[model samples]
Target chain A: MSTQSVAHDQPHASGGKYVQIAVILFVLTALEVALFEVSHEAGPTGFGALLASHFVVILLALSALKFWFVAMFYMHLKFDLKVLRYVFASSLLIAVVVISALFVLFTYNRTLWWATGVWK
Target chain B: MTAAVLDHDSADAHEEHPTSLRIDSRKLAIWTFIGSECLFFAALITTFVIYRNSHATGPGPKDVFEVPLVTAGTAVLLFSSFFVVMALNGAQEGNRKKLLLWLSLTVLCGCFFVGMQVYEFTGFMHKGMGYSTNLFATSFFTLTGFHGTHVAIGTLWLGTLLKDAYKGRIPPNKALNLEIAALYWHFVDVVWIIIFPVVYLMSLFAK
Candidate 1:
């Protein structure tokens, strides 16, 4: 409505910060690829073996960090309105829930499908 | 009039009508759309995870995925995300040249990413992993194909914005146009951020 309010709603723009975040994202991505290589080559025998054991967790953590940086900084969720955050987070939460439910259902309870005749 | 004054005037006109939520409706709508997209992609990813190992008689991840190629593509997409943000920053600062330069780079990165995906898909096909070859092939194609489609769409969106900027249509006050496109582009990047690790890397060890 008012110019003052419009200006207040606009998030601060900073190219330097975006560049910094991009560098961080690139580094994280490199780490992910390197971790994968080490784990794959290690073959459960050494330090790479240890990394291989926790590879999924480590990789997912790195990926989530990259996701967070892009969502919060690149997408301006960090500076924009809280409602936007809620909207995205809630949807993401539901997505996570759906993934978890499906994984649990299909992975551990594979028989449930046959038992319920859903596959039939 | 100074760019600052023009920006203020534009913002005021952009929101002359008060919204019930006290924010730009377009921004809110875009965010909502992004949220729904998360669910859509999540479903695709879930199917992939569920069927990741069901290769029956076709090529699997290790057979078809070239990690180095995909890693490079991922880097390009990530950089594009950065480029778009810079473009938005320039637009908001009323720096027309900066906006056009960064936006053009962003579009190029988007195209490159899409091109890389096409190459990867062709490679998969050459490796005998057709869309209906097996469960793994089907789900993998569906998931990554949708992501590539999004990249193409986003590239077109940014290309249009770049054209607009070149034509001097996007002034400091209209930076919201580019900003919205940037948001969508960033969402695509984040989706791949998840897809890369979950679908590509993790699938390497999938039993």
Candidate 2:
């Protein structure tokens, strides 16, 4: 790469932005914990129960937000080259797919050999 | 062939040759390694999820997991992620003192995290959760243990870079070394970001 392109690809130092991201992440984590606590106390039949039912979805959404912030800002993927983005994102996509499939398969088929018995 | 010139002051000094992707090869390689790590952790996580409730032979998640402690560790790790980036920022700006200071704090955070994990594992063992005690124990140990190992490795990498900075080797031109380490550190942090909620919090309510 030419000097100019290399310099252009280099991200500038922005401590302020990083600190802001960190604060946001902290708040999100607190929210996650708070949500868990609240859901833990939800009643069996009410709006609270409704909220309790969707707890996993909400928690995952919050976690995804935190993941995005760290990946974009701390990892500098937002400012890095597009090729790097493609490589990381593609692999992440495959990983997500594999995880989803495994969950679905295990959830539906509990009689598989590996799924049988605690000691086998 | 383009000769690799050592600038000793510019960040691109170690480019060696023009990469086909127009990026530093080391940076690209680290990202690729991180990408594959995603799948590796994914498989481990899947195993845990499948067997999370198989603790019928021993203590279960609710009986063992302490969310409060893990939340504190999560915060420390998140803060360390911020610290490492600031260190990178300092390094890229040619501010040696700032780099060393933040890097040192980051390493300390890493050590604290690992120590906390060791303590948590010991507590789990005390509760009769050995590696082969049950399915839950096995999967839980394997997953979190690997993550803790990564944190330890990242800590050593950053510690080495900190030493290099002390020797005036990681100048502005060679900040790529620190930057690569920072990327790995941040990747580990993000993986825990997922694990904190998915494994720890969600498991509390698992059926």
Candidate 3:
């Protein structure tokens, strides 16, 4: 989404596109930092809890957007062979599953320990 | 005899890869390696996240992270990504001077990023947070240290390529070399993108 026109006769993205993505990334990072500061100061009660939840979701969404931009545009995965995309995506998918499973198991164990007074 | 030898050398330089997929085998290999590296960094990151709040008696993300400083560093890495692609473009176009200029700039940006990490780690250590300080500290250092190491390696790789470019070695036919390096560089930047939010922003606010 850049207005700056780039002249390219190749199959790859132009410099203008990369600059636009970089600007978008910068904006998203700024938003993440701002959300963190606001969340850090939020009170410990009702409205603050709601704000914090929203903050976490938006912060994560911003991160994902940044990741997508870099992976797709900068890495040229968007224009490269589809098989290469699957190779990277499948590995990422497995990583997500493994990490999520571990997080869930750890959270459950923490809850059980807390109930049994196993942790202070 | 000399003309025949010269033609042989140029033909070899412009030789096409004969592959079933009609694509370069070297490119496929780099992508495969990148895929494996994805899982590798994922495991490190997941470990960091799991131990994010497990700092028994050490400083936490909220206390240690300087968002402004890191934002600058992130900008540097992102710009370096852009630079590498531009450098590749120059290489593909066979503009030796353009290739050398952009590659040098990219390498400089990478060095600046590594320097920032060194400063950050030193500051943390001075503040009593070592590798063995706590789970949070250990995981933080490990995840980020590994990334910084990758950036350092990438910088060295590009530097070597820059030397070759200066010697008039990286022509359009050999642009795949720069392309492969660019892919690795972009991957490193993407890892930091994840790390910035997951490790820094999330932890700073999760507290």
Q: Highest lDDT: which candidate?
A: 2
lDDT of the candidates, in the order given = 0.85, 0.86, 0.80
The CA lDDT at A2 in model 3 is 11
By lDDT, rank the candidates, best first. 2, 1, 3
Better of 2 and 3 by DockQ: 2
lDDT of 1: 0.85
lDDT of 3 by residue, B1-207 (tens): 121122113222322434444445555666777788888898899899888998879888777889888888988998898889889888978888879888999999999999999999999998889999999999999999999999998898888888888999887777777777888889899889888888887887774
Cα lDDT tens digits for candidate 1, A1-120: 232344425556477788889999999999999999898888648799999989999998999999999999999899988899999999999999977898887787766556777767
* Poorest stretch of ten by lDDT in candidate 1 chain B: B1-10
Off by over 4 Å in 1: A1-8, A112-120, B1-15
Top candidate on DockQ is 1
As a whole number from 0 to 100, the lDDT of residue A92 in candidate 3 is 83
TM-score of chain A of each: 0.82, 0.79, 0.75
| Cα error of candidate 3 at position B159, Å | 0.8
